[model samples]
Target chain A: MSIADNIETESDIGLSRTGKQREFAGSLAMPHDYFVLLKPRVMSLVVFTAFVGLIMAPGNIHPFIALVAISAIAVGAGAAGALNMWYDADIDAIMSRTSNRPIPAGIVAPVSALTFGIFMAFMSVMILGVLVNWLSASLLAFTIFFYVIVYSHWLKRSTPQNIVIGGAAGAFPPVIGWVAVTNSIGIESIILFAIIFVWTPPHFWSLALFRSDDYKKAGIPMMPIVAGNRSTQNQIFGYSIALAIVGVLPWVLGFGGITYAMVSVVFGMAFVYFAFGVLRMSPSDDEMKPAKKLFVFSIIYLFALFATLLGEALWTILL
Target chain B: MDNIVIKVTRVEDERIELNDKQKKARRARNIAIALLLGLLVVVFYFVTVLKFGPVVLERTL
Candidate 1:
């Protein structure tokens, strides 16, 4: 059954027939439901990248300031996730993969999510501006706006290249972190941004290939939905190649040390190999195992790459 | 359909009203969250004050 029909049936099981009553029922959401709105997993990655940026910058910030900056960035990322969930509730309700989300599951009222998200967004940006640097604050503001307005509202349903352009919003954290420390943007920060921006297409497309049905049901113009599986696979392979190069650029450019270089080369090759596997798989393969493998490996690849960078930075400081 | 609707509404109302124990636990949790949020605000304020020193305090005055 369609998601709307499912929600209707589900809500009717324990609530009144009218929409208003269903909303009222949802208003009694628990604290955990509110936490789910923050998208904790995504916030962790944002916090890590921003921390790396802060540490890797030329100078040091006071520990308290660094903590505050990172916290603000984390809150900002969570705010964006909440806003995305708020705006995409309709599509989210339809998609099997997203059907259990707080809004669609009748755990939280949509209006509450919207108001909470807006309030958090304003709070984070103001804290970053007043307590930290305005440059980072402005970047954080733009990131939230771009993610909510440009990507979620405009590009998601309208274009297959939604992720390609929208990826910039995620890529801004490290740059914001760098600005938080130095009050300026540098080549190193831009390279960090480039790594993530280039990494996004391949990373997200792999999942899209595996879950194309979800996007189709949700009417989202994901790469695999608009373009055929073959086209998506080919594009994944192409972006993987670009990501491999960009992933290694830090080591090659002398910013990263031997440890990072080794890690990058190994993981970059593995990424390409996974993408190649996806490309070679037959379209009729029901499991889409290769795409799933690539999707899982992509997450590991990003974490390992950043962890290596952080380790190298710490190593330099200690030695 | 009418009977089902009535039954569902009753269940929803019961779900919304927490038992005494659940209410106590929820209240405690809310208090903890409020304290944590307050601590964060205090830290931010002090850090701002430390960074800007007398300038911030003077501006407030």
Candidate 2:
């Protein structure tokens, strides 16, 4: 059977399992399958960062329009993610970590995934353009294309610097968020972009270290695969330091206050500690405790950074 | 020798079947996406160029 048929069967069963009465009552109503295409965890981060950027900007955007713009950006990010999954389905099937994704699990066809992504991408850019501004719309369009074309198709297979170069696409959401509000880039948004760009390497490399075998099996030359663990660890350390410095840029540039500075300093120290653990630990430890620590810490690092920005914004407004 | 030949023939047949289905699915999906993209373009053009459309921030001031 085709993957589409499998998905239909699964959905039917899922609905039936709930109760026959409910299933009979709403037999024609299909669950929104496009939700799976969104990669919700990644979308959440994109939304949060964009929200922070929007709030931190100097100008005022109508609340409803701001919400729409953020939602559009999130949808666009998810669209890029779905398209990426469609293109990389072959390699994804080989990697254990991604082997059970909707495409490979027979829950969504690759073609369906591609269609969903393309639809969302165009809709998002158009919505943001109409409801928000052309600057934001154009940035959103370029970000989607950059991720799909430049990063995924061109850089991923050919270069070790894939994450480093492609990281810029991920970094653009905050700047896009800023533009959505003010319709222009500024020091604050650029600093936020820098923070994410510098943070991407260490965050991703940690996962690459622990999942080295999976990456190798997929024939993807990750940092640990190509450059070896020690070099990857050293690179992680260097990026961590740069990330820490960038984390403090908003405060230093006088766009933020003491609270953001203090929170950033503490966040940076925690990140450096985790990176140092990765650098100091032995490769043969097998459990990959340090790399795992860094991976978990990385998420907290971003959350804390943005949360602090929101906190500062609130404090300034209230007091 | 006969068994090996039969197994190889079956595999080839399965591969060909999968390829045909994949192609059909691809065409259907592409057409759907193209329609949606065209709709999006029309919406954007109307919003930007229509005189009675919503005010754009860039145009004001």
Model 1 chain B worst lDDT window (10 residues): B1-10
Q: Can you tell me which runs of candidate 2 are displaced by over 4 Å?
A: A1-33, B1-61
Clashes of 2: 0
Residue range A150-171, candidate 2, lDDT tens digits: 9989988877788888998889
- A94, model 2: CA deviation in Å? 1.2
Candidate 1: segments with Cα more than 4 A from true spot: A1-26, B1-33, B52-61
Highest TM-score: give the candidate number: 1
- C-alpha TM-score for every candidate: 0.85, 0.77
DockQ versus reference, model 2 = 0.03
